[model samples]
Target chain A: MAELTCQQCQELAAELALDVLPGRDRAEALAHLDGCAGCRETVAALTATADRLVELLPGAEPSAGFEQRVMTALAPPPPPRARRWRVAVAAAGLAIVLATGGWMLGRASHDLPQPETDAQADVRTVMFAPLTTENRQIGEAYVYPGQPSWVYLALDIDNDTDVPSSTVRCELVRRDGSTVPVGTVPIAKGYRGWGGPAAVDRETLATARLINSNGHTVATAHFRHTRRR
Target chain B: MRGVHLRRRPPERLPDDMLLAGLGAGDAQLALAFVRRFQRTVFGVALAVVGDSGLAEDIAQQAFERAWRHAGLYDPRRGSVQTWLTSIVRHLAVDAVRVRRPAPVDPQDLMSLIATITDTPERRVLAGETSTELRTALAALPPEQARAVVMAAVHGMTAVEIADLEGIPVGTAKSRIRAAMAKLHAALPTPRADHG
Candidate 1:
């Protein structure tokens, strides 16, 4: 095996500080740094230099409400046991009410043949930014209260439309107006295609918005949830 | 009112280390101060990487929250509060950028930032004497090498991405960045231990 020299170590150390070292070289460079104090100091100095360069970029003030958002995210998690207790109590009360209503209805309509159960599943679709006759937005989501939900979204664009090469990102907007990033897909700028089949975990679905790389809202669709009767 | 007056002490301004410690202890006011002190740098780094203000805001928020949560683990011996916080912001921003391809940044973008800094206190400090030194050092490098280093440092562009942007070969791009860093390391003063 060829012994790694000091010059080679210095070169790799620079790459390590920049974070552009190919993964294949990372192990060898790290092994060198493990035993070499001088190289370690050099890497640290380079890292410090790289960090100061961050000061050069023009600063952008965060939008209004950004501080509030950070504070909210850092707030302590609410007591889940209490929430669960409340939900259990509500479910029990609902069951009792349904039983009583069934008993009352049976007594009143014994002669009437039992009505056919409404077995149809409700599916909802929404459209956002129906800009032109040729361009439209359509989406559908299936959600069950306690399980992960799946979604599908599509955007229609006029063939003549000119869009720069862009990627699509989708967010799951909950009823309370909070959002969770669901997924992202890359496609041609003007290419019309479906955005997801993304699985959503937390937060009840309220809407999904497709956004471009420039943060433009290409289209949005509202979701309506219905409980089985 | 009398009890409140008796209990109140003047809000003594603490140094950055104390403020960081307070943030770790969940001192809300200190957390706010920390955020205010560093938000510009955090937001600036995020904007440089993602190139979208809204997305940059999200990344900055995450960076601050992460810093606060992990403040207990911060060891001043390793680096300064600013250095530690900058690392957090850079990590988040780079991850955000690497996961997706953002709009390509033009070299001309550097000129816009080079415009004489004004408005914010932080920028004033950045534009002050230290930046002059940094600018001089940057000027000493070949223009192509300087641009490549800036692209790597600011935007967290890898060698391959720099090659694509600069229309150079990947091997050449990598060498340029490595060579640039060596020159910069030689040029800049070793950051003071005070930064730790």
Candidate 2:
């Protein structure tokens, strides 16, 4: 409750004159200035200085064609209506691939079996106990490549489901028919299921599967690696 | 001849909002309007700060080009369009001043101009007397302190910015400004002299 020193008042004076103090600090400085004579004097001096500076350095206006240049950089592309049907057709094709999980296998090729209808393979859907009282929903699958023959599998959650607090196991099947259990991840209420990537060569992994702690199949997908064109 | 006639029109009289909207729509005419509107103010502030017509012209051109590229970011909520635009010009002019290191008195021409046209006889007499006293007091200060005070008092730079530009500590900059103010306060004519 002691009087604030001149230095503290000075700092506040400078900051207030510049309009740079945070809200709470500004309020406190103003409250202090209300009763402090020295601080009030300091504020007047600073204001006078600011006014004089403004007078001394009157501003110049900008040049011609300035807005045109700025507008040129900021202008949006022409409306999509000009090419509406073409864009719509492309979007519809992308929607089909996403809905059937056909694109998932294409991305996870190394973990999928090469079937006769390889391009048309559908991901196997397994129903687990309702993830919530509401219902179960499927999420997108993601595959991330890592060094020295490892790939991460991430299944994005599609709904706010109350998943049971438990662990889920994943298995990877090799092209030569050998199988190996991978890591487990917790399936808490808000958790997204991920298996720590299994260390298997690209030539070996042909299929991947997930099962809950109760031994019920939750999801399955095949993988096939394609040669680059 | 057509181009010359078009060039002579004042930019501020143009419909700036329409041009700004056009700019938002990605049209080139907005840039043309923007250049015409602010060119003079930018050049004027630059000349005032740098005190050299040539440097002012160059700085004004650079500042305008930058404002053009960044125009889309302007928000009407904070300040008027002119205020925001002129703030850019002011900062760019200050930069020119820092870089050129021109003699401080050279730029005092603008101040001298302000001193010349007195609105009233009394004001004229007072401004003339104070201007002489102010100059004498300013000349007595150390060059660094004088520059710091002048930049702060004349250009509205914060003490921190002055310190950064001058390569000194904030405390030193603040003290310099305070000392310069004290010197000027002492040199100011007594209140009795005004009554006489």
Candidate 3:
């Protein structure tokens, strides 16, 4: 195909900026943009320009419970091991309590901040869905905004897995498909593992996953980092 | 004692940008503040496009969720939080309209549109000077040009849809939108690097 001239690129710039370019034209414009820095800048400025029209219409308030609904929709699914883990953890606590014969019934030292409250407190939840059926592990990462490095991750393993703590690994997946090892996630309270406030920043982090010593992924989930300020 | 002045304390509330930054960081209080700050604009634009309070509510909800999820991606250099968010709500609202084929644009809607533009509290508090310039520039456009652009923008109309609405040729509709964009850009001031 012949190289597109600046004029052709400019003509399509306005339409593309408005997101109204026909598919064929859009494809052609993108092809040109791959090689044209000037056109890219023009498109960006024009897009900003087109977006300004939004300010003209008056602001209106939506009905209540809308935020609640959105948050609920975005909530991470219950961990795969939750059902079994709940029973095992409770039973184990009871057994330890009965044997020791000293501690209070509800007092276990492994108490982490409940994520429901964490979410209510405005900590962003970075949910990772299972990448495959074999990898039944799910993850919910909590981080205070602007402090991406200070991530608190909860990894839920499948009820059947028995990987030793010495071999477990957790990683932060990035948009470019690279992985950064954050730390190990041990089997805490039977199939539930927690790790991090890892030194990893949220800038490129896309997914958080668990891996076994065998180099196989145990569970993986994706994250959407929309706020970049 | 009469001549002594007390030092002023820092204001307790975060500015819009800081609140958004906090929301990006997953601060719940700031998230609520951000919603309180921009919900009206988000919902209003959605309402104008979708023409139903309920559907607009859905669109607005999705828009805010998107803002929260993608807060880290927002660039202050590009536009203010208000303008960037306005774009998101407008696109979602327009998409909602496309999907449902909601009520056709009534002439009275334009009168109401004018009223909203004139009376919005957000326009004064949230919108920066360029937004004001944009409003004036849009007003200065020939009525047909302004209408054509609005139809394309808030309604997500194509050149053909705009042509059908105005009883004009597709090329004419396209040029009117293009011309309006040009005029608006010319009339507005350059975006400030410092403002969010």
Candidate 4:
């Protein structure tokens, strides 16, 4: 039989000591050890070494309350019946519009005043400006105006890294008595897409506030008419 | 007759996949049974890797919980249940080690203390003479090498996994394991002592 190289024997020794070799490799290594006294001695030493080290490990058992604690942590909370009913009613109402094809897909486009030059117009392009609080930058608030009665408020968030995918509530508050919900912005890419047509009663036309699903004011804009026409 | 006898006989032990299947069925009793069977060994491995009793307990519980949750993912073809569970505990321990900064105890002092404490006849006898010698040898090794051996033997991690966890090259991890093993081999009692 050819002698096993030191490296080959060492690798086998490590594998045998760790008991990590696959069945075939284990068989081959054992075969080699059977005829080779040196290799056999090496394997025996390694095994003894492993066996001894195994005993020094701490033998502390899990506490008696472990299972109960784990179960409690994993247990699902009871359903909120009242809340579910409200949601069911709201869903039923939505189902009607969806069923009847009453879903509105209206789009209103308004061109802002042209800049003095093409460069200025290009520079005047709207981009999300981040809202900063407590020295932590939270999100970018979208700023654009479409009509006097309506404001387009958009927040580009990376939902993947930012928001937890829980139910989020969005609301638009006008300075006047009128308040309207644009709709819940599905958090995508960490940003909340909000702002659609909101009917601002003439009485409450002083200012508008965009509140996110968390009820925090993400952005606010003052009412100033660019053209009275 | 021999072939007939072999065909009729039940396998000596149930496979890990079957055990895990029993666990996943919400068989709390089977789960308890499994825990009872492996708890000491698993805890021992965790304790060896982290070198802390409290951390070992946490690691054991977390490893079991993870096993419970992902039991369905266990494949019998890959390895035994013992190996799989060991791998999980070791991976978690390695991660814990990386995230945790050890207190400023001098490695040499700690090693010396371990050597002295484990050197007693009673301790040696309790662990078996071979184990005592092994522990002493391990304690005498460079901290990194000793850590590598402990992580492999107790936690059941591959050299690659240990290197990745420790942020060292694979070759470095292998060398540490080999060096630690060599030191342990040299430290064993003479063959005469073993026979007697």
Which candidate model has the greater lDDT, 3 or 4?
Answer: 3
- Give TM-score values for chain A, per-prediction: 0.35, 0.34, 0.37, 0.28
Candidate 4 C-alpha lDDT tens digits along B1-196: 0010111111123334434443543345546666666677677667656767788778777777656644533434334566567656755664566466433233454454455434556855785654566656665778788767756665556676667777899889878887777777678674411210
Give a tens-digit lDDT track for model 3, residues A81-136.
Answer: 33433533343343333233211101111122222222222223333333322433
C-alpha positional error of residue A192 in candidate 3 after TM-score superposition, expressed in Å: 39
Q: Over 4 Å off in model 3, which ranges?
A: A1-3, A64-229, B1-12, B111-128, B191-196
In the range B43-89, model 1's lDDT, one tens digit per residue, is 87788777789989998987777665445334455566776777677
lDDT of 1 by residue, A140-193 (tens): 222222111234333333334454455667776788887767678554422233
Candidate 1 chain A lDDT trough over 10 residues, lowest sum: A116-125
Error of 3 at B41 (Å): 1.5
**lDDT against true structure, model 4:** 0.50
After the best TM-score superposition of candidate 1, give how far the Cα of residue A93 lies from its true spot, in angstroms.
Answer: 42
Ranking by TM-score: 3, 1, 4, 2
In order, the TM-score of chain B in each prediction is 0.79, 0.52, 0.79, 0.53
Segments in model 1 whose C-alpha atoms lie over 4 Å from true places:
A1-3, A78-229, B1-12, B114-128, B191-196
Superior by DockQ: candidate 3 or candidate 4? 3
TM-score between predicted and true chain B, model 1: 0.79
Question: Which ten-residue region of model 4 chain B has the weakest summed lDDT?
Answer: B1-10
Residues B31-150 of candidate 2: C-alpha lDDT, one tens digit per residue:
566656656666766666666676776666656544433333344433345545555555566655655543434335533533321123455357674345545556676866667666
Q: Estimate each model's TM-score.
A: 0.57, 0.35, 0.59, 0.35
